[model samples]
Target: MVLSKVGKKINDYATLVMFSHTIFSLSFAVISMMLASKGSPSIHTIFWIIVAFMGARTGANAINRVIDAEIDEKNPRTFMRQLPQRMLKKKEVIVFTAVCFLVMVIAAAMLNPLCVMLSPIALFLMIIYSYTKRFTWTCHLVLGITSAAAPVGAWIAVTGEISWVALFMGAANTLWVSGFDIIYGAQDYEFDTINGIHSIPARFGIKNALCFAALFHVVTVILLVFVGILSGELGVIYYIGLGIISILFIMEHRIVSPDNLTNVKIASYGINQIISITFLIFGFVAVIVK
Candidate 1:
């Protein structure tokens, strides 16, 4: 029974990490390679970068879950989380977080000196984002910027310097993430308000929050366009992919209304996944084809 309980706890922990979007974070590393290489980065470099991204993301998320245990226990949608439900002990999470952070640091060390130096900053921002909701509705933006760090970090890992193109990609991702996060927060509007937590939905209400989300998405697209233009690296394929992204964004919004949130999952997971994968593929193709 003890072994079985441990296995269940491990599964629960895995579920939490998966939901934290570690895969999405790794995808940014892939996109960064696409942007950095004139053609393609070495397979070894890609491997290490992916490992670092995943480890860092996992560490950040585990810390967030541990810190938010109290909040999760009070929120209906989150009360069943591993930590809140007592499926995983606090000590277990602390050890896991340490392991994840160690792995990230080691992976970053293997990548490059720049990546190694920046790893702490990236981890710091990731960890900070979870607490931002306690004080400000701008938490979503902080989370967005945290996610954006993946591509920027990857770019610096490869080039060992900052570039305007990389900054543009980061900005574009920031807006994209912020927009979707606002939509996702809609589900917790009431809970957030009651708990004195700040979020766009809690502060502005659903309808206006959705409007802000749309506006953010528009800014995302504009930034992406500028990135393509400034890099001069993308071709017709990239534009086509961008068009598809636009359509997906539109469909995502159409499915979710202020009064009806039945399509929340579709908008959040379905369309966002499509957008990320599209960016990865097209971004890679543009570099390779050029």
Candidate 2:
């Protein structure tokens, strides 16, 4: 009975953090790690990278939920979330977040001195992004930066140094995330405007926001092309993944519009997941072939 209760509670926390959504960033991180290692990272490195990502993402998500609890309660679309629905207490979530961060720091320490030094900065970026919506319409970009940290940090973990290739990977991730985020934010246009929560959609309207998203995605592809070139390792397979990603991005935009955001979830979540996984697979193949 106690075990079952514990299991359920663990599941609840996972749901609260949207744990499965880790795929979105994990794929990019893994691809970056492989590139940094020239397609041959140690198992130990891989384990710690995965641990760090899980800890950072889960903690960041938990804290975001706690910080935005009241706002989420007021937003019709988010009112059913764990916090707003009383599925998780504020203190419980806060404690969980702290534990997750501790795990992240420990994982970083296990990796290298550089990763240890950078962990706190990554944590700060992740935490600060949640509050950006209250003050700036650039919140989506802030979020993209936070998400980009995953790939950049993974690259550093492997090479123990920064490189242009890593920066290109980070930039690609930043623009890709920011683009889809603009589309996702459109679903909350009404709630955000009324609540004074800044977002591209709230500030510029959905139609214009989608346009900006498309532009960002276009740059995302270009930056990815640069990443391929800069690495001097990735090849046809990587570029093929980019092509598929471009098509997926187009499909993402086609399903939603200012007048009809009913499929926003599919566009922002489902398609992005496929894109990430597709990139991860093809990137690995390219790396191995080289």
Candidate number with greatest TM-score: 2
Model 2 per-residue lDDT tens digits across residues 78-112? 89999999988999899999999999999999999
Which 10-residue window of candidate 2 scores lowest in summed lDDT? 19-28
Clashing pairs in 2: none
Residue 56 alpha-carbon offset, candidate 2, angstroms: 0.4
Number of the top lDDT candidate: 2
Q: Residue 153 of model 2: what lDDT?
A: 94
Model 1: per-residue Cα lDDT over 1-290, one tens digit each:
99999887777878877654555555656766677875677787787877877777888888989888999999999998888878788888888989988998898888789888888888888788989999999998998898888889888878888899889888887888899989989999899999899999999999999999999998888888887888777788888888988998999899999999988877877789878888778877877786
Whole-model lDDT, candidate 2?
0.93
Clashing pairs in 1: none
TM-score of 2: 0.98
Off by over 4 Å in 2: none
TM-score of every prediction relative to native? 0.94, 0.98
